[model samples]
Target: MAILVAFGTIDGAGLARSEDTSVDALQLHGPLARLLRPLVRLFIRTGMTFPALSQLLRELYINVAEYDFALPDKAQTDSRVSLLTGIHRKEVSRLRGAGAPVNVVPAALSRTSRIIAYWLAAPDYTDTTGAPLPLPRAGEAPSFEALVSTLTKDVRARAVLDEWLDRKLVSLDEEGRIRLEEKAFVPQNGSEQQLYYFGRNLHDHIAAAVENVLGQAPAFFERAVHYDDLSGPLAAKLETRSRDLAMNVLQEANREAHSACETDAGGDWRWIFGIYVYREQMKPADKDIGKDAS
Candidate 1:
């Protein structure tokens, strides 16, 4: 339920390259202090919360070096993760897996093995009789045939990969051929480094959301609803679960920011969504409700 908010290409921040724009600054640095300036009385709005999109980031392939989570303002967490992280729910519903993030071979494949496999398997590829295709490089999406041609050369592996591809762990190019099919999304960079950016992006998002909440909240909220109480290490947890929630956020924020969303809002406001994995879990609570119903 913790959602990582990202302003995709829609915001005009480049998805494939980092831009030194103010939006990128908002993503990399906290701006509540500055945003508060000259705008307190100015009307503002909290943008849409893309909880499903956050989970998609985890389940799908994010070429960290190539793609940045652009949060021009701020991003915030959804409420469910916040709630669920507290009570180790006795009846935790299993969130369906985010499909394999690309079907590329695991990085563990050593150089020599890659060579051997390429030689032995490349020829067997169909146009894929079926050997899997090589994974695409960051930002270099490929067509299905191209992906299949690269990863595999025979049938059996292709079948398994085909299943994964259908499920979205892999995606094809315009030709309806396999392209970005790397299954194992190993952090090509240091794991911590990758997580750090993920968390920062998430961090910026949540901060922005909370900023909106704080700015919109009544001049003085009751203790239970105060901004600080809902954020920080102290808010969102019972005494027993505080540290757990804090640590969970700590480890994940650097890896994925919405880990905080779980705690953002509890009760009816919460939702769990991950398009690449559990997107199917969501549906209209009532057909008559608007998109904002959640």
Candidate 2:
């Protein structure tokens, strides 16, 4: 008989079906939270860093299942994924062995196929072309424990590439699956274009917000405003300054710490002083109807 497991995800909860035995659920948590964690770690290994991963986890964690990547027609199967990702099937297994997040102990593997199955299948069944495949044609469905066993192998690969990624890029689903994601890779056409994307998105976003607040006047902002500074004489002066004076202070502050950056509504990014309004829109003038009448 097929076993079902539940896992918690940052985006939402999911369910996976596996060939392994079913287990009990957590109270402060649910069955889903217990299932889908391991995949989060994989994402970290792939190249995202911890802070980025945490940012993604905090804002949006997807409750993925086995079918999302394991289904035959709709999703990429394990063997196929092993090939595509350039990691061995055995290696994936070892990586997973490092630990899954669901169990209270965080030592061995957990049976999370039902929850994982849903995670794998959801995007394929709903968003993509993959279908609701009942089972594999070539082999028996992997036991939930076996699936965990298989995935643990990727740890070696993770070791090789850990420095390139941030810790946040790796995440744990409730079922113990690992997952990873970073900004989509953009093919670099020229010099550091791709490298700039990460910083740029944030810089532009903050710049636009400052502009809106300033209306027509050129706006300026500062970065790395230390808490201690906020309590000092500079803070009092900033609070009392006129708009232009404040903008200058912001610009000067940014110059002092130009390396610091910020993001705004549009997602564009710039350093505190790196952002500047080059042009200003003039205010509308009053109507002159007396000259128009014939």
Decoy 1 TM-score against native: 0.17
lDDT of each: 0.34, 0.34
Q: lDDT tens digits, residues 75-183, model 2?
A: 4444654554455566544342232232142221112222233323333222233322222112223322233234455434334124213434234356543343222
- Once model 1 is optimally superposed onto the true structure by TM-score, how far is the C-alpha of residue 207 displaced, in angstroms? 1.9
**Candidate that would win on lDDT:** 1
Q: How well does model 2 score by local distance difference test? A: 0.34
TM-scores of the candidates are 0.17, 0.15
Where does model 2 exceed 4 Å of error?
1-176, 179-197, 213-226, 229-294
- TM-score winner: 1
Model 1 C-alpha lDDT versus the unseen true structure: 0.34
